[model samples]
Target: MLGGEEGIAVSGSAELRCFSAMASLLLRGIGTLVKSLAGLSCGQAPRCSSSSLPSGISSLQFSSTRCFSERPTVRDHPKRPLSAYIRYFMDQHVILHKQHPDLKRTEITRKIGQEWKALPDFVKEPYIVAANAERQKYKEEVKIYEDHLTPLEKKVQKAERQQKLAKRKSSRKRRELINMGKPKRARNAFNIFMSEHFQDASGMKAKEKFKSLFDDWGILESSRKQTYIQLAEDDKIRYENEMKSWEEQMIEIGREDLIRLKQRNKLKKLRPILKGPKVASKKKKTSVSRLKQSRKTAEPNEGRKARSRISRHEE
Candidate 1:
C-alpha cells in the first residue's frame, strides 16, 4: 500500500507539468492570431515572430498572401475619358443631321453669305406694291387740294377787289350829296306878294288881306275850279321843274351848312377863345330878341296886353 501511494503522487506531478506547458503554448498561439487579424484589418502586412508562431501557421499565412496579391483591382484596365463620351453623344443626338423640304442646302448657304439678299417673291411683295400705290394716291389727292385752293384764292381776291370798288363809289356819291345845297326857288307869285304885304301885319290881319286879294283877283271862284281841273296835268310838270331847282338850292345850302359845321368843329378843337358858354347864351338871347321883334310887329297896341297874357300863359 505504501508503494502504490508514492507512485500515484509521482504521476499526478508529471500530469500537472504537461498541462502547464500546453496552456503556455495555447496562449502564445492565440496572441499571434490576434496580431495577424489586426494587421489584416488595418490593410498592412503583419510581421511574423518565429518565437510566437508555429511553423505550420507561418506556412499557411504565406500561402494565403499569394492568393490575395494575385486578385484583380479597378486601376488595371485602360479607361475611356469623359470628354470623349460627351463628344460622341453630341455627334449622335444634338447636331442637325436631317434636311427640311423647303430650305435647300444651296439657298441656305448663299443666304448665310449675303444676308441682305431679297427673299424669294412671296405674298409680302404684292402687299408692299399696294401700299406704294396708296401712298401715290394720297399724294395725288394733296395735289388736287392745292389746285382747288389756288382757284378759290383767286376768287376770294376778285371778290375783295369788287367790294373795295363798291365802297369807293358809295363814298364818292356820299361826298357829292353832302356838297349839295337847299331849295329856295319854288315860291309862287301869290306867296311872294303875301310875304311882302304881310311884313307888318298880325296873324288875323294877314289872313284878312289874303282873303281880300283872292276876292279882288277872282281867284277864290274861277281859279279854284280851273286849277282843280288842270292840277293833275300842270302840277306834274310844275312840280318836276320846281323840285329840280329846289333840290339844286338845297344841295348848295347843305354844302354851306356842312362847311360851317366843319369850321365850327375845327374852331372848337383848335381855338380856346371860341369854346365858351357865353357864345351859346348869346345865340339863345338873339333868338329871344327875334321873337320879341316879330311879336311887336304882329300885335297892335290894343291886342298887345292879350298877346302878353297869352305868352305868359304859354310860358
Candidate 2:
C-alpha cells in the first residue's frame, strides 16, 4: 500500500508538470502572436526569440518568411507633420474635455472652433511657428526617406496612394448617391438576360453559370434578344428621366456636384447660351441692303432741301 501511494504521488506530480509546460507554451505562443500583430500594425517586421522558436527554426528564417508574406504600407514611412489647426486642436482637446465633461465630442469641437476663431492673432502665433518648424523638419525627413527608397518602391508608393485616393472618392460618392436616392444606371441586354435566367443555368459554380448564360445569350435569336434590348432601352429612359429630376432637385438644394457630367451637359444644351449664332436668310439680307440704299437716297434729298432753303433765304 505504501509503494502504491508513492507511485500515485509521482504520477500526479508528472501530470501537473505536463499541464504547466503546456500552459507555458500556450502563453508563449499568445505573446508571439500579439507581438507579430503589433509589428503588422506598425508596418514593420516582427522579431522572434531564438529560445521560443522550435529546433532548426531560426529568427532570421521567420523574419524572411514574414517580410515576404506582408505587403509594405505607408505606415512604414515617416508620418507627415500636423497642420497649425490640428496642433492647436490636439492641445486644446484635453483642456476642453476636462472643462466640458458633460458636452459631447462634436459639441466640444464646435466650441473649440468658435473659440479658435475668436482668438487673437498673437495667441495663435506660437502654434503657427511650431507648425512651420515641424513642417520644415518633415520636409527634410521626406527628402532623406526618398533618398533611401528605390525607384520601384517610390512607384509602388505613388500607385498605392493614388489607388487609396480613388477608392475613398468612389466610396464617398457612392454614399452620397445612396443618401440622395440617386437612380442606378440601366443595365444592358446581357445583364438583363443574366438577371432573369441566372439561377436556371445548369452549373453548380457562379463562374460556370455565368459562362453558360453568356453562351446562351450569344446563341439567342435576334427576335428574342430584341425583347431584352427593348427592355434595356426602356430602363435607360427611366433612369435618365429619374436622374434628371433628381439632379434638378439636387441643384435646388445647392448640391450641383452630385449631378453627373452627362446630366450637366444636357442642362447646358437646354440653355440658349450654348446654341450656335443664328444666320440671316438671303431674303432678309436683301431687305437690309434695300433699306440701306433707301437711306442713302433720302440723305441726298434732305441735303437738296436744305440747300434750296438757304438759296431762298439769300434771295
Task: Report the Cα lDDT for candidate 1.
Answer: 0.57
Give the per-residue lDDT digits (tens) of candidate 1, residues 1-315: 459889999999999999999999999999998777556732455555665678767544433355445433222212222332233333333233344446665664554334323435562355456556666776677566545554546566567769999999999866765455322234454554455556544446767877766554454466554544464455456766755565446445554333335544664476566564568788999999999998888778648889889999999
Count backbone clashes in candidate 1: 13
RMSD of candidates 1 onward, in order:
64.0, 18.3
The local lDDT score (0 to 100) that residue 114 gets in candidate 1 is 46
For model 2 the local lDDT of residue 74 reads: 41
Model 1, runs deviating above 4 Å: 41-43, 46-315
After superposition, the stretches of candidate 2 with alpha carbons farther than 4 Å from their true spots are: 1-75, 171-244, 250-257, 260-315
lDDT of 2 by residue, 1-315 (tens): 469889999999999999999999999999998776666643465567788788787544455445555565543777888888888898899998988789899998888888889999999999999999999999899888888887768888999889999999999989979988999899999999999999899799999999999899989999999999999999999998998799889989988788988877776777655564545576788999999999999999999999999999999
lDDT at 176, model 2: 77
The Cα local distance difference test for each model comes to: 0.57, 0.86
Q: How high is the lDDT of residue 7 in model 2? A: 93
**TM-score of every model versus the real structure:** 0.15, 0.43
